[model samples]
Target: MLTAADAELARRETRVTAFGLVLDPAALRDRLAARLPEAPRAVRVDYLRYKPGTSVLAGLVLDTGAGPVRAYAKAFTPEGAPEKLAKHRGLAARAAAGAGGGDVSADWHSVVDEPAHLVVGTARADRRLPGVGQLAERPGRATGPDASVRTLRYKPERRWVGVLGHERPARLLKAHPPARAAAALAGHRALAAAGLPVPAAERVHPQRCRGLLSLAWVHGTALDAAPADERVLAEVGALLARVHAVAPALAAGREAAPARPGLDAAAAAVGVLLPGLAAEARAVARTAAARLADRPRTVVHGDFSADQVMVAADGVWLTDLDQVRIDDPLADLGGYLAAEIADGRVPPGTDPYDALAPLLAGYRPCGARLDRRALAAHTAAALLRRTAEPFRHRHPDWPVRAATLLTAARDLLEQP
Candidate 1:
């Protein structure tokens, strides 16, 4: 059924089915034979990232003589198959000289399964993400500087963010495709220029290395990782108000109204990955479409959540500014509310919104008046859009969890 999309995207036949083969360990052991020192003792991988009819990126841990070597592989459409063979080979050679440590090294490889009609590129590091090695060299601590790079997140060909050192990192290095380099720089620079409690941006580029964005680490425990103090909530609320006060030009794009809710792609993704819940996901989308109240747009931190902030004596620091855009202020409020409810910290059998009391109390005084309807609708929209995350994150019982999130979204939209 997925192959039905080939003609539409100009992808090869079985483009979707072929990518699935790469996830089969028995098949991978043979396809990647040249790279493995011997028959792989075992293969560990998860269907971590998938874009139907396009690509799939998965984390891999292979048993080898040296122990489990961590790596990644991306299986993609073969429209430009012939040309990428040489490109991948060249990049693989270049990466062999790049510095790396830990489970995965910088070495790379590629293999094409002609029968599958797909190009599979595998690497210990993200070749598409530029300048990580250079950013890793920056200080990892204020004084002693442990400086070991630890992956915070990875979504191949899209993003790879790593924190330097441990416990308390001194820096965060991000690598996205170069085409998005300018937008990434603008978001942070604008926030910093506005005197927000966000990290200062340091550009990474020189003749020898590729361009990347490096951020001074925000010191303090992240709110999501620990209990969030009321004071921390207040500080975060005040900081967000300041961000909304910033001129719209500070961030370049505007978010679409919820009536045209951006969950269309996410809903479609549900159809492919969790077909049983696809209809409910679509119904939730429709309910959200009619529930949003019109409001003036402001600068919004497009992806605000408890995980996006770190509290310290000096200030509450914000990170992850890539999604900065002009939109309904309630959009951010929704992001926060959705995360709070989804986090499961709220006592069982109690209304989830009770968790937002401290946050909203802190918000109303410093920020615009709350629009209860808009907030409810926006939160539902956020939950709906994120319903696919459980599957994408490789949870073993993802379907049940994903269904719970959908139920929450539907309930939120039902609010009168």
Candidate 2:
């Protein structure tokens, strides 16, 4: 017979082993009650974002024995949790005001200046309507292990997304939190002015301590799962070229690139967590760093990958503009190629360079030149960095995969 203590342990283990999460429904209810006392009993808890043993951000629905009310609950061990929560509350208040078409003088800045606050199904006081139409909250795409990076969609074409991870590794962010959101908003506007298909940033709350960005949803399917062909790939290449073309204007009056991947630093970062592979990872980083010297720099999409670009019937559009910055253009190309290669877009033992030929061919005519050495170096760094990411902690085979990528990075660095 299983003891009570054993049963609780098994239940927690199930949560971690199965869903990559350990959530306490009772604790979640208590938090919700504190925030929304008048709301009824919490009948259900949904995990929107879960990083096992680290953090879990969830969506809660309460039934006041009358109707349902929705709210968010976050549980984590990162530093400054109290401050982050306070910031989020401010963001939520601003979002509420925006949705209600209230003045935003205190909390927000307008990017496009259009009324993007009213989501499709939200209750708006329209002179033309008879009764309030109930709006449904839909789940948006999940980016990674950190639940905070996911989206909470109030409508199909509009979303509430923000950076909720506090104290993320320094390698991920060089600028402070508020600056990161402001830069991203700047990127969105610049891309839109340049005639790119990115979504319009509607309302942004970028205070000195914390910030959040809510984008008007651009309807589309993610290219990673889309049925992409040469035509589709060509469109993607052309758009990237267009992005690079506008880098200079975006970076104007702003700080230079936030961080550069130095070989020594990259190796040190990787080795700090995985001591066994420190020597080899550092050696590869050093070689790649030397080869990357004197490469041309431009505004690169810091986190470009197939999943980041979306494909709609009209055209291709990109999302997650948070990492935009001035850097080697090849970093964008290399990051995309690295993701594709890891996802098996390139067959094992086949050169990713060869596989990327058509895309590069499409890009060349758009006035961007391809540098093999720079691309390889950036690609190696991208792969090495992936080994230390939060997502790696959840993957059962991450050890084998990380080692394989490191070896591959060494080989890529060996290329002339």
Best by TM-score: 1
lDDT of each: 0.65, 0.52
Clash totals in order: 0, 0
TM-score of each: 0.81, 0.60
- Model 1 clash tally, residue pairs: 0
Clashing pairs in model 2? none
Writing each residue's lDDT as its tens digit, candidate 1 over 1-416 gives 21223122224325654565554566666666765435557666654577666666676666777565545666666764556555665655654443444332433344445544544443334567655534433323211233456666656667767666666677777777777866777778888888888888766653433546678887777888857578767768878888888987777664544555367766777767667788988887776766664677888888899889887668788889987877888888888877766676652223435656777666768846777767777888888877877766555456766788788888776666
lDDT digits (tens) for residues 274-362 of candidate 2:
56889998788777767766777777667899898889888889887767777778888878877876776764345756867767766
All models, RMSD in angstroms: 5.2, 12.6
Error of 2 at 203 (Å): 1.8
